[model samples]
Target: MLLAVEGLTHRYGDKTALDQFTMHLNRREIVGLLGPNGSGKSTLLRVLSTLVKPQTGRVEICGFDAGKLPEAVRSRIGVVFQTPTLDPLLTVEENLLIFGSFFGISGRALHERVRHLMQQFGILDRRTDFAKTLSGGLRRRAEIARALLHEPQLLIFDEPTSGLDPAARDDFWKAIEELREKRSTAILISTHLFDEAERCDSLILLHRGLRVAEGTPAELKATIGGQIVELVAKKPEAALETLRAKFGAAIELSDGILRVEAKDAHQMIPSLVEALPGEVLSVGLHQPTLADVFRKVTA
Candidate 1:
């Protein structure tokens, strides 16, 4: 294991942030921490990256105990926070140079490393541009480039694609995939986006400061074992109660829509429609997705 978290627990005043959370992370695998807001994803990242110490538990990164040997753990991991850390006044190359210096990287070696990383991120052409002038996507690429300057073994990103448009998000993920192939480094990213979570090799689903489930996306979705039925109904609450009572279905009202998980849902759809009659405005059935899996586990 490249990373091991054992019985980690953290609390803030009256509320618990992490409750005996534990997991193992393999080298070169992309593991996503998937959760809604306030799910302890950020707290876990903070603990893993040594920004904050957990009240209890052990975190070993690259064989170094994070609590006792933070410097060693810090040397082997790169972190990209949800907020950009680039100085707006500095050019892309300057920002990378400053970050490289923190790792005692200087002179010709730093230059070559910066050049290589810039090329890898497709931002070599933008190296001379001030960070404030770059678009959101370009700035994100620059942030990633800076993070890789030291060639850390583990890279951590917290909602790296947040606030990006579809095209920018696509570009950012392409860069991540390219880096994964080129570096063969372990990656851990926290995200609430289903599309982003689906790209990970494994997932840890968190809810209200506890780990709810963990598996590959396909494996997690397989736990549902059938189709997901979503109904936009005129009276979703009533429909949900009626359906759950009549069919004993696993159902709920989310975003004013009735959602259900059923075996062979396509075959049962007609009956559901017939039974609901005028209550349902529209219905949709599909294979269980990461979103469905999240709902099932979190619920």
Candidate 2:
């Protein structure tokens, strides 16, 4: 196991940030900490990265206890924070070399490692450019390369693609996939984006500092099995009551929209339209998605 966390709990004053969270990851596995902001994803990442001591629970990384052997754990894991870390004044190659030096790597070894990582992340062509001169996507790639300079077995990313265009985000993920295949590194990333969560091998969904759900994307979506029928009603409250009477508790109202879950949702559309008459403004039917699953589990 590359990473293992059990009964992890933390607090800030009176507010709890994480509660009895437990999960594990292995080499070559991509695990996502899926949640919205303030969902304890960042807290958990801090604890695992050995920056924050866990008030309770055990965090073991690559056979090293995070609390007891933080230095050891730190040496074996790389962290890419949510915010940019590169020095704007330094060139890309210079930034990597400086970070590598901090890890006690220097001279020919550091130079070789920086070169390899730049090439691997497709930032070799931009090495001579100052950090401030690179685009958002190129800067991000440099940061990831810097994190891997020491070749850590596990990589921890906190909202890695938080501020990038769609194309840059896609490119970032492709690099991550290639890294896993080539280095067999274990990745534990925190992300709120549904598309990014869908790409993970498995996901642990957190909501308000609690573990709401945990499984593969397919498994989580399966929990909301069948189809989801959504419609905006002219009279939302009245339509909700009407739909509830006909569809039971499966019918719910959110944001002035009526949602119904059923095995044969398409067949129910006509019935729903007839029941509401002119009350429904529009209707849509689709299979379950990560967003739907999150809404259901959090609801």
Output the number of the lDDT-best candidate.
Answer: 2
On residues 1-299, what C-alpha lDDT tens digit does candidate 1 reach at each position?
78999999999998898999999887778999988888899899999999997679989999999999999999999999988789999999999999999999999999999998888667899999999999877888888778878888888999887766776677667766766788777899998888889899999999998999999989999999988888898887888888888778677788897877778878778878887988879999899999888877777
Model 2 stretches with alpha carbons more than 4 Å out: 165-167
Clashing pairs in 1: none
Q: What Cα-based lDDT does every candidate model obtain?
A: 0.87, 0.89
Error of 2 at 122 (Å): 4.1
Please write out the lDDT profile of model 2 over residues 147-266, one tens digit for every residue: 989878999998788767776677678877877999899999988789999999999889888999999999999998789999999899999898888778888888888898888888
Against the true structure, what is every candidate's RMSD?
1.9, 2.0
Error of 1 at 272 (Å): 1.2
- Give candidate 1 misplaced runs (Cα > 4 Å): 164-183
| Weakest lDDT window of 10 consecutive positions for candidate 1 | 167-176
Question: What TM-score, to 2 decimals, does candidate 2 have?
Answer: 0.91
Q: Quote the positional error of residue 246 for candidate 1 in Å.
A: 2.0
TM-score of each: 0.93, 0.91
